[model samples]
Target chain A: MSVSAASSRLPGTVAIGRRRVSVELKQFFRDRNSAVFNFAFPMVLLVIFGSVFGGQEVAPGISFAQYFVAGMIASGVLYTSFQNLAIAIPLEREDGTLKRLQGTPMPKASYFIGKAATVFVTYGAQVVILVAVGVAFYDIRLPSTALQWFTFLWASVLGLIACTLCGLAFSVVPKTGRGASAVVTPIVLVLQFTSGVFFVFTQLPQWMQVFSSLFPLKWLAQAMRSVFLPDSAAAGEVSGSWELGLCAGMLALWCVIGLVLALVFFRWTKQGTT
Target chain B: MSVRDVRKSYGDLHALDGATFSIEMGECFALLGPNGAGKTTITEILEGYRRRDSGEAQVLGIDPARGDRVWRSQLGIVLQTDRDLGDLTVAEAVRHFAGYYPDPRDPDDVIDSVGLTSKRRSRNEKLSGGQRRRLDVALGLIGRPRVLFLDEPTTGFDPEARREFWTLIDGLKAEGTTILLTTHYLEEAQHLADRVAVISRGRVLACDTPDRLGGRERSSARVSWIEDGVRVETQTMSPTTVVLELAQRLGGDVPGLEVHRETLEDIYLSMLDDDRDEEAGESA
Candidate 1:
């Protein structure tokens, strides 16, 4: 037999992908900055916001702190899953890490799946911590029924997937690792404010409300509100209803579009000519 | 592996005009060139990292441009720049890369072979530049590749580190690994490569064994000696005849006699100079 034929067979794609996820998670934990930003920063935001606005009432019965908890959770999902990936992917591409992995036998799909898996794990843990903080210190209530819990589960899963996919799609915007923060930070800030993460949605101007609705952040915030807030608290929302169906549909649409864009534009190297 | 009439261009710049070469299995072939000579363009095309505009590149009996994961698994690559998996220890990094291969060498053994056994527990970020390079080699070798592509592998290495790297490469050659190396270091080419291809401006100027490159073996030799306390030097097509004549004239051994031939560096530089002059003439 020829030398090539004599060599061992290539491993399965899923097996290598699992290894890539393990390796990526190991590296993620080692980066203390990312650890704090993805896992701890959201809980800190929850405490700060809950303390300042916990007394004010958003509706007849629900307090502003209770309403803000759902928004904060939505912002946490976007920050950990989307904003983090937007910056990290570009940085990795600039530093030649993506190129190195491309040269390996591991499939490109596996590389992306590994990154998505890391986001899910880290962001999932952050969600758990935020829920604990909301319940323990802030008098925030959990979903009382199995049906509400199911709604919460699907919203969280779909929201995470949508934001993470958008992050991957935006990875090509930054020219270098140093520029990633400059490109992503302003967008995240604008999204948080316009989506009513801090202010009441009904208080924002109609134009700003329409503008925010163009992106996924507002819908994600609405989705979380549907799960966490009592049904009467919907009066404070832009439409006086949760619009849970619309929220899920928008998130799923963004997921499809983002997945397609990422697959098309994702780069292994910083420059096209090289 | 063979590359024939390969052509690649970036806008108006021809990164690879037309490069052609081949490597026999188990032979160490060096692509010797200066910076921006298209050595990287050729190497990347063969590695399947980049595509060629027009050419035939067959690596391990398969076209690299269309090669699959199975084809990729058979080749090892040590890039010019460092690949950062800096958070992991040396052993962890090596073992992680090992998982990508079908049948990989033991990670511990690979690390030891690269002389990084002592640094196995150290994080990649903490290792020095030379040590990082050794780790790169270890990662490349763990795949147990039949062919290895090393692009300027010792560019930033210290003299001691360079020599040590040469020893490690020698061991790989002895184990029958086909190595395709590119470097501007002529001495490295002379020491390690069984055959050398001199490239300049996206073109192959000449390809031959290091000793016979540019017809150096048949070229004139420089004979230097001391006569009447004065040093004299002359170039001769036959150094033996010159030496005999000098011995007869001196009636004994010539004082401070030395015979010098064209070194690999001398021939390589002159070849590049000649190519540049020819291009200048053509453009004029």
Candidate 2:
């Protein structure tokens, strides 16, 4: 019986996961300041970026609010995946919190599952909040059909996977807590800005636009826009089925890469390999 | 539990260089070392956390490098660092881990054993330093592991807390649980270990009963007594024989006489000094 197998026989994965969720929620939203960070901060950024931008030119016709809403939610993936995972994962590793858990017969998968689950559920709520604000304050419309909402959800999931993978890879190089934010911050900032979440990619210089397409951020934002915005309008950033397939494929590839790094570097003892 | 010539390296650094040791069923074995002495490397290999670079290791009849469900089920590990549940109470945390093992002890019983029953409902992060250490032991023992590994189990404890923790470990020893412990504190090693091994720089210097290592038992002892109201002292190879002679001269209890040989700590410190001298010599 392997460690994972031994852990499989245990019933505490879901129970522990539930406990971890309750604990994280309280810790992350314990105060008024935290509430601002978790909820209002992102909405404020959306407003600032959405209004201040000069209008974009797109071949497909769409409402500006519809286009901007998806981009805002893609930014939510940025908040949930890269920024969120980077801070939490490095802190856990530095304080030896993860080391302590590894010795227990707890299934290792539950740790990742618990973390990703919290991010997904919390960010899910944040997405609703962002969308609600978009509708109430910015006149953004709801998807006209169920299919569009489903597509938006699927695209968000892909973006989450890709960004999380990148975060995990980036976490490997940050050996200490104080230095970790410095290492992960620049990459996150550049990726977030270039991915077209804050602005349209085509309007950038041609060379910069080419560089942005290589990252999952642009593809994810592009895919997300395809879902939430009406196809009849030519106002969206991404154009065809080929771009959507490429985004999904690239995100899946990054998932494999992230999981591999996480497994190899995982430590569960007083002495850590990392 | 047996580990044979296990070796591990961290890039150019050799963390565990052919380290080999084991604890029989129901035995208490202590590993002693400084900060970077590879004690952790060897113990981690036994815990199935880090991969061994070379050689075979068996923990509870399974190779830890490939320990299975039953293998993992039979062993428990207590890390040097404490775990965080943030808001989960002590009882809740212990109960949570108890669900992971097939033959786990009762959560309440384990909590009481570690002297954390009063703090059972208190959030883990709210516990005092000693209280948290007790909670750490409670989680380790919850699984009723056949072999328990305790790494520097009581580093931040006060004198009273340390004594209480020792009593708890003695209770575990009485139950036939094998304990493999690593510690930096010499007094801690002397107090709890049935036998001790001193290692430095990725190698084991010696392994024996506390009184037997490094020619410890046969070394000359210091005898002190008040003779005719004047304090007198002498050194002798045999503490018991000296005491007997003093008894004969005094015609009874040997008038304030005491024969004291070097303690386990004395032996341990000498070993450490030897290590420093060797390093200095090599550099010179």
Candidate 3:
């Protein structure tokens, strides 16, 4: 007998990708503890840092809160894309979620695409909330020109891709799910401190400035600063100019590196792990 | 599906040492063994979840190690132990899995078939052990799989639940779906399998119909009777001859006569013991 009454043609990747995204979203939001913490932590940081430094000015008119808003946007993208996946993926692996998916007919690419899409949606919402908070309470200004908005768009998307890939690569480090947050949160915290998300990049110790430049966070924050802060404020940056091209280039480069590392390190089953 | 001389080793431990078995279409084939007897190893290889060190294996006319997404869609797996999808409700999990197939059964129908319709709206973690297993079966059936792999599917089930699960599998067998089952329960194999392979020490010791596994049908039967206020018992290859001789000696009617043949469990245990003895001799 035939397998079924319906057509036997396999569903397209697009169909499965969309379904996966919806399922991922549902799973994410349904877990109230994680949903609350993941979305709230970044905004909470923006409030605390914005309040402490709201009165200071770095470029004659740009308050520290305004400056901090740019860094927070960059940092928010990292939280949603990198930190979230780094913790979540390992947990799924430990729970046999990845193994279950591997046994299915879903194309492997669609699984990653679903994750990327979920990151994009959640990161997009995070940016909106961060921008709204910046404008309402921190006296931060929105980008005035279409070019600035365009810059905002590309910078966020590139950073999200880079971080998401990096997160997938980094997920293999934690031996078990219970220890993932303990390991992952510290690395993200360190990146935030050194990458100008929590402090002015130029004022950080010279060694930190040199070290953070190698990673995506510094470039992401710099790119965000270029769009949100005035053109005149670019002089205050460590490079003495808004190196938009370099920001894009470094992030693009990290995307490649992250992809290669993820391909090499990702394990679908615990038995495959070292 | 067929496996020829499949071998897998973890360092010094031979998980599947040249094990071989072939399952015909529409057949309920059971792999019976004790723990660490390579049942899960061979099943995982056929499911494409693991690669064999060296051998030839295929499922649905394709090499499982190289099986692609389309090849995967035609198969279903109920794992030995998995706690995934705990966050999704029963219906949600079934429907989500159904979307992965090109042609899938109706999600609600599959859920009902597994007897999990009552827990449809409950989260997977909320279900009892037996209920969770039923949900696993629901997900396995949602894709209308032509071949289903059930690895110790009812390991934690109560006796009543096990019977219900057997009935469910019987229904699948009726529908002509090829089922590959691995279990420690000999009765489960006897009740559901068309054929059973008794595996021990990473080898196929015997493969035949459940009734004839390890020559159980031809093996000696115990003939016992009450004679002269004493109980008498003897094992014989031909119980008819022994019973007739006893009746003739006892004047045509033997009191408390009883004939007993070896059960599948008895045959299976002896096979395992013999295998262990062989291993001990080799090591010495």
When 1 and 2 are scored with DockQ, the better candidate is 1
True contacts kept of each: 0.60, 0.39, 0.70
Name the better of 1 and 3 by lDDT. 3
- Going through the candidates in the order shown, the clash numbers are 0, 11, 0
Q: DockQ for each of the predicted structures, in order?
A: 0.55, 0.32, 0.53
- Sort by DockQ, best first: 1, 3, 2
- In candidate 1, stretches whose alpha carbon ends up further than 4 angstroms from where it belongs are A1-8, A271-274, B225-234, B240-257
lDDT of 2 at B73: 64
- B1-284 in candidate 3: lDDT tens per residue? 99999999999999999998899999999999999999999999999988899989999999999887777888999986778788899999999999999889999998888888888999998899889888888888889999999998998899988988999899999999999999999899999999999998889999999988887888999999998789889999999999898888888889999999998999999999999999999999
Off by over 4 Å in 2: A1-38, A50-66, A226-232, A235-274, B8-17, B237-255, B273-284
Shift in Å, residue A151, candidate 3: 1.3
Q: What is candidate 1's lDDT per residue for A1-274, written digit by digit as tens?
A: 3545534467777888898899899989998878887777777878888898887888787877777888887887788778888888877876567877777788887887788899888877887888888889888888777766787788778888888878887888887777887899889889888898888888899998999998888998888887888877777777778888898898899888887887787667865522
For candidate 2, write residues A1-274 as lDDT tens digits. 4455655556566765665565556555543443575578788876765566413433444445566677778777877777777766776777767776667666666666667776777688889898888777766767778767776777788778766766665566677755776777677678767776665655667777788877677777777776666665434343534266677787777677766866675443325554
Would candidate 1 be rated incorrect, acceptable, medium or high by CAPRI criteria? medium
What TM-score quantifies how close candidate 1 is to the native fold?
0.94
Comparison by DockQ, 2 against 3, better one? 3
- What fraction of the real A-B contacts shows up in model 3? 0.70
Model 2 chain A lDDT-worst window of ten: A233-242
